[model samples]
Structure formats: C-alpha cells, structure tokens
Target: MARSLDLACRCAQLADELKAKDIIVLDLTRVTPEFDYFIIATGNSRRQLHAIAEEADTLMEKSGSARIGIEGYDSNAWILQDYGDVVLHAFDPASREMYDLERLWADATRVDWQAYLAEHA
Candidate 1:
C-alpha cells in the first residue's frame, strides 16, 4: 500500500485505541488530488478529542509524517490535523452531526480500516 494510505489506516487504528466513535477513513484519491485520505472520528468529549489528536500527531510524526498544521485545538467542537497526504479530524458529536462530512463527500470511497487493522496486527 502507499505510505499515505498506510498512514490513513494507522490513524484510524490509533483513534480506535483511544475509544473514538464512528471512526472512518475516506479514500479521497479519486475525489481530489489535494489529499489521499480523511480519517474522521467522533470523540466523546473535548479532552478525548484532544488526546486523540495529540496521540495521532505524535505517532504520525514519529513515523516520519510531519504534521503540516493543526486547527481547532481550542474548540470543543472539532480538531483537524493535516499531515500533507493524510488529514485526520476529531470531532464532538454535535459538530460531526452538523458538518456531516460523509454526506458531503459521498463520492469518496469509505475504507474498511478495521479489517486492515486486524490484518496488520
């Protein structure tokens, strides 16, 4: 697999480690050239969201995917981390429902990250 896709699935796996809810990775390769995947997860609370983001950032960087930037850390609604090819979004329930990214990017293929994680493990 491409490194980008691996990172994306790893992000999903990490999110699952932190007990994130409704985790999904959207394969955006066909949707746009801007990025390869989007790992979207809903945290139970702000602290959980922060933990998920921080851990993901550390893990990605340690794996050589330096973070380009992070946004919405101050907010309890959503936190977005950009690692060039892969972007992970940690959102609270309300914000996730409000944004409805899956519906917005309906064309993007939904990845079976859990299966990938199991195989990798």
Candidate 2:
C-alpha cells in the first residue's frame, strides 16, 4: 500500500515537473476495485499532455509498475496510462473540464500529493 501510494505521488510529481496544472491525486482504495489511485493533471496543449504521459510511463516503469495499457494519445485531448495499481490521466485544459474527474470521483479521497512529496522526499 505504501509503495503504491509513493508511486502515485511520484507520478503526480512528474506531471507537476512538466508544468501540468490542477494536478490531483485521488485514492480509490475503497471507492473502486479497479485501481488504487488516479493521478490527473491538466495540460495546456497536446504537447504538454504527451510530455506528462511519456514521463509518467518512464517513472512507472522505474517504479516496477508495468503499464497495463494506454488510450487517447492521438486524440490530443487526454492521454491515459494505466498501471495495475496506478492510472494517470493527462488532459488538455478543455478536455479536463469537460470530464470533470474530480467531481466524477468525488467519493475518493483527494490526496495532497505535493505535501506527500515534500515530506517523503
């Protein structure tokens, strides 16, 4: 559990490093059985979104998390990288607002990922 949380928070940090905005880390432990955490971020453009996704893929790999799959890369609106326990959603600003994942997954716990990084790092 701690390992997964660390991976999730590190992925969120990756998005932040790439200048992704409105980054969120949602703990889905009790909310869903499908995954453990959802790391979502809003990118201003397609390039930025791709950068976040790409970096996340690399980070997850180094964390010993094999990516299960990916989606919406060509769409240039949202890119999803699914690890078994952690999933990342990199979205364009408009796409993020349209999806409103925060509201959609309101039941999940919103993790203060930045604080986690500061304290843990």
Candidate 3:
C-alpha cells in the first residue's frame, strides 16, 4: 500500500512538473480491487497530453514500473496508462468534465499530493 501510494504521488509530481492542471491522486485500495490508486490530470491540448503520457511512461519505466497497457493516446481525448497498481489518466479539459472520474470515484480518499511531494523532497 505504501509503495503504491508513493508511486501515485510520484506520478502526480510528474504531472505537476509538466504543468498539468488539477492533478489528483485517488486512493482506491479500500474502494476497489482493480487498482491501488488512480492518478488523474488535465492537459490543455492533445500535444500536451501526449507529452505528459509519454513522459509518465518513461519515468515509470525508469523507476522499474512496467506499463501494462496504454489507451487513447492516438485520439488524445483521454489517455490511460496502466502501471499495474497505479493507473494514470490524462484528459483534455472537455473530456475531463464529460467523464467526471472524480465524481465516479468520490468514495476514494484523495491523497494530499503536494504534502506528499514536499515531505519526500
């Protein structure tokens, strides 16, 4: 659980570095068995989304986190990167509002991403 949380927070920090908006880390361990956490962020454009997704994949892989699957990168509406325990969602503003993942996972606890980053820094 701690490892997954650390990975999720790392993903969130990466998103922040790329200037992704409204970055969030949702703890899904207690709420769901499919994944340990969800790292969600909003990108302003398809180019930005692709860059964010690519960088995230590279960073995770460098950290020994193998990406299990990736989807929607070509479309760029919403890119999903599956890193086993940590799934990342990079969405365009319109798609983010339409899908509303936060609302869907409202039961999950939101990790204090900034605080986590600060503590680790």
Best by TM-score: 2
Model 3, 1-72: lDDT tens digits are 888888889888888899999999999999989999999999998988988888988888888998999999
Least accurate 10 contiguous residues by lDDT in model 2? 57-66
- Residue 62, candidate 1: Cα error in Å is 0.9
Worst 10 residues of 3 by lDDT: 1-10
Q: Give the per-residue Cα lDDT of candidate 2 at 72.
A: 97
lDDT of 1 at 116: 77
Clashes of 3: 0
The TM-score values for the models, in the order shown, are 0.96, 0.96, 0.96
The window of 10 residues in a row where model 1 has the poorest summed lDDT is 112-121
Error of 3 at 101 (Å): 0.5
| lDDT (Cα) of model 2 | 0.91
Cα lDDT computed for each candidate against the true fold = 0.93, 0.91, 0.92
Which RMSD does model 3 reach against the true structure? 0.9
In angstroms, how far off is 9's CA in candidate 1? 0.9
Candidate 1 lDDT at 111 equals: 93
Cα lDDT of model 1 by residue, 56-95, tens digit: 9899989998999999999989999999999999999999
